[model samples]
Target: MAHRKVGFGLRGIGHAVVNGVGRLGYASRFFLMILIGSGASFRRIHLTIREIYFTGVMSLIIILVSGLFVGMVLGLQGYETLQKYGSESALGSLVALSLVRELGPVLAALLFASRAGSAITAEIGLMKATEQIAAMEMMAVDPISRVVAPRFWAGVTSMPLLAAMFSAVGVFGGYLVGVVFIGVDVGSFWSQMEAAVDFRQDIVNGVIKSVVFGIAVTAIALFEGYDAPPTAEGVSHATTRTVVTSALVVLGLDFILTVFMFRGV
Candidate 1:
């Protein structure tokens, strides 16, 4: 009996492993199709532009407000901490470094995932559920080329701009609290920040992170939608999954990228 149980358990484990690999293979095929389809889909620039308007413009207000609040908090906390050491002039370095190096890209991606990622997943999932995707296929249209590619490309393009705006607004907010509210010297705030925050090291790296996160979050959103079961419940579940999965993937990628990008620093 014990031997039989062990054999059954081993078989179950192997079966699970094989199933996971099969799913991974299917996902890879789907991803490859999107990449190949994206080329000709560019001709549908109008559709991509519409998607950008939906994803980027619609989300701008929230991103702007969140950036400002976060910057203000950082300014207050940084000033309070540094004042104890009589290094209040370093407030600029602190805020800029925090925002550019880490907070800006990560927070923007998180907000994007919560806002636009969920919407994309829900939209695609609804199309799948309503048989719109199938209808396109029945008409000999490739759904990936016609539907998914444009949205994917739009998201990849929009993320950097959104992140840059978030960082810029956040810096201004920090300036308000640090310089005007707290009486920190304006010259030290700007000059110290300029001297310490390297465009290449901090700003460029943040942009790279935003780009990588954008690709990752958008890819996950599209995948979840495409793979959703053709049911209302499935569509809802995929939307939820997009947000949760995007968050995890962004944080994981941020850690990995940080280790590689700033290891020497």
Candidate 2:
């Protein structure tokens, strides 16, 4: 009985691994197709803009509010720690570096995944369930170009902008707390931040990270929705998977990108 259980467990592991690889392969092909058909989105432009409105504009309230809160918390924590070391003037550098280098891109991406990514998954999944995609195929309308490509491009374009807004608003929140509420010197705060946060090193790298995350999140969402079983339960499950998988992928990619970008620092 013990030997049989071991054999069954090993077989299950193997089967899971094989299935995972197959799904990955299918996703890769799907991503390639989106890239190939992306030209249509650009040619029309309005479709991409409409998707941006849905994914990016609609997400602003949550992103801005979250960024503000996160910044306030960072300011409080950083000020507490720095005061102990008599380096309170360095508060600006601390907050700015934290946001621009890591927090802004990562937190924004996670939020995007939870909000817009899940929505995209649900939308496409429902379309599939209703046979809209099939009807498009029958009509030779090229659903990928008409539907998926615009969304994918919109995500890729919106992510970096959202991240930038998050970081900028976070900086303001930090300023409000550190300078206004806590009575930290405004000159020292801005000066230290200006000195430490390099444009090329920190800002550009953060943008790159956001863009990569956008592609990962959107692609995962699209694939899950497209591949969802044509049922309500399947669409719900696929939406859940979109959020979970995108979070994991974003964190993993952030680590890898940080290693490459900030190796010594």
Which of the numbered candidates is closest to the native, going by highest lDDT?
2
How well is each residue in 10-89 modelled by candidate 1, as lDDT tens digits? 99999999988996798788888999999755787898999999889998999999999989999999999999999999
RMSD of every prediction = 1.8, 0.8
**241, model 1: CA deviation in Å?**
1.2
Which runs of model 1 end up more than 4 angstroms from their true locations? 1-16
Model 1 weakest 10-residue run by lDDT: 39-48
TM-score of 1: 0.94
Model 2 vs. true fold: TM: 0.98
> Which residue pairs in candidate 2 collide?
none
Residue pairs clashing in model 1 are none
Best by TM-score: 2
